[model samples]
Target: METRLLEPMESLISAFVLITFLQTALGAQEFYRQPTHESAVQGSSIVLRCIIKNRDGTVQWTHGGFGLGTERNLPGYDRYTMIGNTNSIDVDGNSIEEYSLKIDNLQLIDDTNYTCQVSPGDSDEGIISNMATVTVLVPPSPPILSGKVTIPVTLEKPTNVTCDALNGKPKAQITWKKDDVRIMENTYELTTTQPDGKRVDTRGIVTITAQPSDAGKKIECGAWNMALKEGEPLWTQATLDVQYAPKLTLTHSNPDRTIREVDEVKFTCSGEANPFQITWRWYRNGELQADVNGYQYTIPRITRDFHGQIIRCEAENSVGTTAVEHSLNILYGPKFKGDPAHVSVDQGERAELVCEAEGNPTAEITWRRQNKYSVLHTGSIYVIPSVREGMFGVYTCTATVLGFHEISRDIYVTENGPPQITSDATQYASIGDRAMIQCLSISSPKPIFVWSRNSQPIDYASSGRFSAPEEGLPFGGKSSLQILDVQEEDFGIYNCTVINTKGSATLMIKLEKSEEVQMAVIIGSAVGGVAVIFIIVIACIIYYKCRHSDNESYAETDSNTEIKKRDKNESPSEMTKSTLMDQWRQDYNYRYSAEFDDVDAKVGNTSGQYVCYDTERYGTMPTNHTNGHLYGEGVDDLGPLNRFENSYSTGYIPSTFRSPSRTDFTSGRVSANELASGRTSVNDFTSGRVSATDFTSGRVSTTDFSGRASADLVEPFRLPTADNTTSKLATNV
Candidate 1:
């Protein structure tokens, strides 16, 4: 009874659970409350939501055809998240919400469909919501147009152009526009994925043939997409360079290309091309002339080598090259060959005058007389069968050309004449002066002359006084006889005789002397010599008086002190200016002052004769003169020094003082050092204290100071001691 009751209860319970499962299964549903199709830019966040009103079901999300995550947890995707049950929150708080798919860091690959699903707790079947698209848009990159940097495009040869847009989502579309006008030409496109795994690449290409009118026209490529917010396409443009070979021409400024030899030539090459600044090259007879590079080529000097040559000009550019050619014709002016400007012929002789020249058009030759206006000959040679006196005028030979000056040669006909004197026959010359007698004559075969004195022949070389023309055959000959340093003996007739093979001529000259003028010159020279002696005696007398007075004006107080001053009105102090000789004179006593004049004597006079006295020699003093006091009074007795009778020596100067350069006597001044030997005069005052000590020690003889010891000379005397010490007067000379 218990087993039967349990079986019936189990059947009722199973039938009731089956009916509830069928009802839940039939009621399950899923749908996206947010947009079923949505869009978002790359690098943004998005959501795919499923809001199901069935309170007993669970929700899930999927990307494309793959599951995203369930309500519990996501397995492989970290950027994907699901929110459901009590943890679910409102997105914008305006619609029913459930577990929704939230994608962060949106990229280009995310531009696909997303779905949401809902199922009852006990059902195996779940309803999938319509896919919601997240279009992660990417603004297309600025379009890039690529082609050759320098393209030679033209209608004759068409070319292709390509443009590309990179890193854009949903592959951009490319179009072409030429010169702002849309082109309906076929465009090819290719699509590719970017390395980022996020964006797409799009490329477009088109073929075009540029026409002449299309040069400088702009061709543009535009990349566009639906996601563009500004509603304008990304574009790039390029300018077309229509190409064509240059139109070549060879031109010249001159109407005639024909030129003279040694004349300059210039040829210019002109060209027209789509691209300018084309290089130009020059060729001569197919050979390149590397020196020329400019648009205008010049030939500084054309020569015979360039005659009949072909000149070509080639203009080249990226498009193509063109060439032009010109033929040359070179002409030259007439040039004389082996022809002289002037020719001569003797009377009654045969004469042949020839003129020759070569030119492009052979020069025409003619002959005529210079004064007469008629032609003499018509060929290269102008012949005179027998030259006569009537043919003595000038004749001309002319060579002519169209573009040059006429060339000419002259033949001067002349006659020969014998020698004949043309000037007067008489000439006169003075004695004791040079004389010349000349014979002037005219001759043809030249002439020779002979000269004679008093009818005797004169040999010019032995006479050493005649000169004539040197030519063996002299024309307009001159013959002359000359007497140089003339004396009474040369006072005679001179004859000049000129002779040639044809004839001879003669001329004569007469010379004489005056004795009165010679006697007057002798008397004048004797008078001049006597006047010179009288002037000398007068100057000496004046000098002696002046010097005697100067001596009496000075006085000596003591040897140690300087020369005492004199009365200012009488004389100036001798010590005002010092010299080597003045210092020495301070120690001596003499009739005439040993003191030299400080003022130089007047020159160009006989005053120099009075400056010849030698003060250091021994001689007789003039009888009446002496120092102001007695000679022996107040003297410094250092030794047995002799008193000089003639302190002013007019005698031979010693070798020691005989310097050829001495001018002190004429200058009226003396050097104290000159009172001693020349070696001492130059070095004594400059030889330091050693020489001073030697002088004071009396080792220097009187001859050292006097320049020489005379027959009445004194022994060496001690120089006066200065404060009992030797004088330090000497130093380096």
Candidate 2:
């Protein structure tokens, strides 16, 4: 075998070896390149390269010993060309020449043996290059289905199917599949060549052992070749005709109808079977029942617990077993909807309670008072047409089904009481953010909600930015007024009233700008604060500078003393208005700056200086700035003042208290608009918080107001001490 292979190789190359010896002897020329074996897909192009060096010779091409004349384009073959590189490349002072064959639009017929013949120096002796065999790839045809088109099998038996792909240049790769899934197990392939000895064919066979579960499924064979489109193969398919055991379907006597307690229901298992005899089995919720081999099972007295059960029936034959299930949604006993209710209404108004239940059979309802045997009312709703004082007690509502259990819910009746609020009285949101003022109150019989702003009723039902929704709570009434988009006009006091059959209670809820706005204001104030402080410092310095000169002119000499003496007869009511600050500016400065509250002004150490406390901190204060008497509430927790042994004036009482501005006692803080609201009184300074005590101009409480001190403006003391002096404050109060 080896000698036979070497004989062919030696014969093809014998001429080349002889030419090499002759060329060495003559010292004439050499072969630089030789044609190489190649494979090309049909319909593409290919090149068989040949080159020679120092060639003073002619080159010719051959196909399987047939001569092909050396021409630019081959004779009789349009796709064949004998091309040469006439412009030779120099190699070590020797020119290298190329005489290569180029083939385009290749076909299977082009696959053959090729050779390049070179004759050196016009000698008759020819030198044959090594033989180069070319292969043209041809794709196989689409696969053909054969042998069982529909393979039939059962659990106990198996079957086979075959597919073939014929006439491929290179043998095709055959693959087996079942229902699009590649089947490798029990699948085999065979390959064979056609008589022509060029093209081959392949066949794939796959075995099927299908169960009842896989009946009516498809099987397939795929043929793949490198010459075909990428990732796509030709396919042939078959289906499975599987024979198995009986298939069962279950049906109940009550189809789409309610089966109540004590009602009879029968379930039947029916199916088609391959075998003559079929064994039946029944299971309830996966637990096998005692009776087997019965096609129908009957439940004579089905109970409520039987509802929502899965009853399955199985049919078995010699081949296999199949099962089906029926789910029971039988309606049964009655059950109450919610827990016992406690309803309350106002005296003499109709009171009612609804008792709801669900059951297959309609439930009967009745109402009765506790410890009283008589049935009060029937039906789902128990109504008390007119409830009086004595009617406030517990009533029982009973729901019953004809043959099942009876359920009861209690209704505790009571007269509604006055509503009391429990939610926050102040709600805040920024501009363009939602603001909800919720008023949650506790009373009996759900209450109604009413909203008002600045003594005017607010109608939330009208399609507007403000909306109030109705709410009903158990023994309470809850309501919220939603400000959809908070604007400048939205921030204010909102009166929320919770009313029922009982008395109504109104809560004062203030919706103001959120803390974000305060933070922005603080930042803005801080930015301008430095410049304002510089200006004030400069003004104070200049005032002191001028005051020093003025003191020299009006120093308590004999002439100034006589002027003071002239004013000595001026009574305590004698007053002089400010020269610089108009009433508005004075009021604005008092509200915003509140310099009297400046604990930093501790010259602050002394007691008699009345406190101007922050209402936000203390929670309450007097809005009435009349008579310049400051009243504060909950002042027992004064911080820095506690460090001093100060006696608060418990004696002072505000007379003729009035709020000239809308900033009343209820809204203790000053609004931005109120600062420039043109509201100003000469001595209208706000003290601290005041109670509802309307002092009828008599002597007020002698008890000294502790932290209630915001220093009085009219410091008309008998001894004529300064503004912050303890003795002067005590005397003036």
Candidate 3:
């Protein structure tokens, strides 16, 4: 506007200056500019556009503000030119500017502000212009997790929830929750850089524990970038499930059972929870009875009361426990009764009494004998013998059942009457005769008979002939006393005692001799024969004195001589008679010779008298010759002699003599000298010349010469021998 200071060098300088000004203004517009975006994802390509504003101007490019042009203007700007476009200008390089800035990849420091400008002249005239700011931007991508999203969660267990955003522009924010409740907050973590130059975004772990109530509950994991909004949530959920089983138990009231007497009963119990199997057991006393799978129990026929009884049941499964119980009261009764009480025995004997009883347990039997001896037994019969008065007392048989009950009975034994006695002999007998005494008894009870003599029991052979018929018996006979020849020794009382239910008896006897009267007659006749012979001798002496009186003295001497001679002859006969008479007197002691003082009166005359006189009147003769002659004779003649001699010859005679006269005559007063010297021959006596003188000769006179002989004194006679006059005399006497 002032047109100021134009010179020759001014006028020419003025036109040059105007042209310099136009060139300066045009070159100032060709500088490079920085991009607007600063940051980029690590592996992505980026474009950094550095814009230049001068069109129709030479342009150059460089890094970190280094120039690519010199002071001298050159065509090297073609290397920095836009395609098909030379120097053309637009404001701030909106159009037709040299836009020559470029970047193949972006980095963090590339975010700084950059300037683009141009230089007007050579050497010291270059300048720079205003810069454009670049800022790199990145958006959030889907996050990835390292561990499981739907996790198996347990109570009281610590767990980690991880969210990794690979190569994220800004690190991500992570959280954890359970059922939408917040558990942990944004705990962002930066992981180490990747090989592709990108970074990892890591989140913190969420620690939590679950309880029993937390079983089957949900737990959650959540992630956010704020770059990724809430509507599209980064949260994951898992359900928690828990598993277990329950426990079981069982119970009972009575564990053991005992019973007394008669009562009723029941049993029961319960079981605990589980998948349980149960069983029940019942016991009587201490013994096991029944087992069942159910709870209720009952026992019928309960006869005994259960004393302190118990019953129990049990339940069991995978787990364990126990429960309460139920019990009962029971009773029972005694089982059996006793058998009958009795005794068995033979008809007339004693026996035993046995009592028996039986029960659940065996019963006891008590036996009492006569209320005295006592015995006990389980079961048996009692026995005894001889049913007598002693066995007649009380016998009790009692039985006790179960030691609690009893029954008894009384028994008695009885027998019949006493025994009897029978004998075989009459009431009386002579001494030395046989007699029998026997005992026979009859009773219901058999008797024992004891046979005794003189109060002492008799042995079988004590009596010469005594014997026992058989052993003692009831109907059978017993001992017998056979007194063979009863004597005064056997005269004592005899007893056959029958000992039985009844009592005893005896028989008495006396023994004596027969023929006392016959003995007396024999004594009288012997004394009478001596007296008659004496009378005859005295009478003959008187008659001779009367006839010789003239030679009185001679007559007296002669008569005296005759008397002496007669005395001599008669004395032998008289002495024999006297000896026999004395012997009879000594043996019998009976007074009978006084009645036979008359000899003729005792033996009267008969023709038999002469036979009696020769033998009987010569009683003092020797008998030695007679025995010798008789022994030599025939036995027929000896028979009558032996019979007659033995009949009257009391065996006191010597064996050498044949007659009793030998004993009587040898003791006679007759001298042996007189018998030898005297001569008294009276012969021719065998002729049939019957004269009074012959009949009445010598000492032969009788009480009546023809009177018959006494029937008691006379007996038939025979001569034993011619020399046997002595024995014949003995018989006649």
* TM-score head-to-head 1 vs 3, winner: 1
Q: Residue 260 error for model 1, in Å?
A: 44
Model 1 scores worst on lDDT over the 10 consecutive residues at: 600-609
Writing each residue's lDDT as its tens digit, candidate 3 over 1-733 gives 2356433456887888896776565554344454453455433444445455433333443435755443223235331322223365456333454343443345544444554445453423444555555443333345555434344333354434455554444555656566777764533455555454534455545544546787656666555553454556466566654322222233323336444344334455554443345444434444556554455555544443343454444433332324343343432323333432323223447566555544334455666653345463334566665543234333556656553556555443223433334332223335767755534333224556677766778777655567656442212234545667767666645655656544444333222233234756777876786787688567545533432332233333453543333333222243444443444333221111111111110111111111111112211111111131111112112122233355332112211122222123212232222212221111111121222232123322222111111111112222222222121122111
- The full ranking of all candidates by TM-score, starting with the best, is 2, 1, 3
Provide the lowest-lDDT 10-residue window in model 2: 598-607
**Residue-wise C-alpha lDDT for candidate 1, range 165-200, written one tens digit per residue:** 887776798989988998887678988988876678
Error of 1 at 501 (Å): 99
Clash count for each candidate, listed in order shown: 13, 19, 53
Question: Which is superior by lDDT, 1 or 2?
Answer: 2
Models 1 onward score TM values of 0.28, 0.31, 0.24
Q: What lDDT does candidate 1 reach at residue 34?
A: 42
Q: For model 2, how does the per-residue alpha-carbon lDDT over 1-733 read when each residue is reduced to its tens digit?
A: 8989899888879988997776565455667889999998899999999887767768888987887887768788788897778667574556677889999999877889999988756543557899999998888898887635665456556655677888888888887766778777897788898887888888877777776777778877788887787779887777666666687778888877777777899999888887638888899888889865589989989986777788899888655678998877776778888665666666688987888877666789888765456797999888889886456555667888877778876565655555555444555677888877766555554667788998989876673888877565444645777788788988888887777665667667777676543777888999897887698568656644643454345445454433332232222221213212133233322432312231110111112223222332222222111121222212321222222112322111112222122123223232111111223221343333332121111111111111121112212101112233121122100
Error of 1 at 208 (Å): 3.9
Off by over 4 Å in 3: 1-17, 23-141, 180-198, 213-733
